[model samples]
Target: MNSPWYIGDPSPSKDESLVYAHGTIMVISWMLLASTGILFARYGRHLRISGRRKLLGDTIWFQLHRFILCMVTVATLLGFFLILIKEKGQWVSVAKDGGHIFAHSVLGAIIVCCALLQAWLALFRCNTDSSFRQIFNWLHRSMGYLAFFLSIPTIFLIVTESKVLPMQQDGLIAILSLWSAWIVIVVILFEIVEYRDRLNSKMGIYRVAQNELMDQTTSLRRKMDHNDGANIRSLNEVKLFLFLLHIIVAISLTIPLVVIIWRQN
Candidate 1:
């Protein structure tokens, strides 16, 4: 008789193990991406309006975030393959019963789309010239909505599939899923609120600075206007600080995810 735990002779059902590991990694990657989004939407937006220079830490964090995103993309692809190859046998049962597999497939598709949008935004749209800033911003905003929509299915998959896992069936996965969902919601809401406030404040600042520059343009023609220079310098400084803060936030959010994955394994 074939052992349930051992799916086939000399093979101890690596599917489950792969699924678990890939799931955990995906969770971490998602959290990091969400954290980066929060920072960019909130603090980074403010910095852009204020015209701040980039700081060292900010540069490092941006690069690190990009690197992690790439890794996550690869991992997600691997997960797709693992599910397709290893779980082929169970697909029929999963599909016929309309259980976690359905939710997983839906969520997986959403995730893939969001990930692609993110990549496009980060690599192509974001680097466009100022003339296309509005277009880029619109794309970025749409991607954010897509990410939010994707999160719902992902949460469903996590909660529903956790019950089927042998070692992870003790409510740990459900609890974690709930906790992560809460965190994502809180962060998104907080950033939205902050974004509105920053927009208002930055517009006010820009108007005042522009007026001051206009007043000085006549007297300081063809030369560096002191007040305008000061405003530009101040904006650059704000950008630098915002960049550093974003990195700090990303690192802080990643720590808990790493810990959870370690504990789970």
Candidate 2:
């Protein structure tokens, strides 16, 4: 086998076309992965959202999630291959200002591995009353979140590395970067708000229980249940908002790439 140092391009900054293709493909991949991951985690997992009016169900959402995961896997592979072919002998570039390519490559590999692991675990997931269901769900969900988070930095680095100015003579990479950053920030803030509300809901229930009179146990139970229901309602509402956010992000991310791809041809 060849040395580890000889696998990627040593001078990626010099290749404008390679940078354009790399940035474009990776950005498109991120858009799909982010949208799918958000949908599965926030909306698909909930009975309130997925089970309403039979609009979606566990199996339906699960299948859709898996299908999009497969797409993410394919997109990741394409991006990885593009980097390897274009950035020859640059893996682990040791200079102070270099080697980010190697970092990007390694990160992409990790996300791909996480996605595959999640998919494999999904195969064994079952509906029967088995003890493994909880473990399987936990593992699947954790990996999904991890992979999506990992992709965030990879997308950021790969896009920003390409200095192509939007509407400039060279390329439109800069605008794509802004769109990506905006979408990521919004989604992240939304998730933060969602989780904070969840924590408050749990804390509210705990406090209510703690402050209840020993003789008023039934009343306390009623209060707890009401709070829990309200919490669920708020979570579903957030999920609905997230779903809309996903649509906007997806459209914003895709339209530019599609237009550029068409223009490139």
Judged by lDDT, which candidate is best? Answer: 2
lDDT of prediction 1: 0.54
Number of clashes found in candidate 2? 6
Q: Using Cα atoms with residue i matched to residue i, what is each candidate's TM-score against the true structure? A: 0.57, 0.59
Measured with C-alpha atoms, the lDDT of residue 93 in candidate 2 is: 49
lDDT of 1 by residue, 1-265 (tens): 1222122224443334555555566655565555454445544433432343344545433444456566666666666666555555444234353456566666776777767777767777545467888988787667656664575566445445533332334454555565566556555654555565566567657866776767655555434445545554565465565555545654564565445434442
Which 10-residue span in candidate 2 carries the lowest summed lDDT?
1-10
Residue-by-residue lDDT tens digits, candidate 2, 1-265: 1222222334443434554555566666667665665566554555354536233444545556666677776776676666667656455443532355457667877887886786677666776588778888788778877877777776555434432222332334555566657666766766686676768767877776676635556786788778777877777677667666766767766767656643431
User: Where in model 1 is the C-alpha error above 4 Å?
Assistant: 1-15, 46-52, 55-68, 88-97, 121-123, 126-133, 166-170, 177-265
State the lDDT at 92 in candidate 1: 28
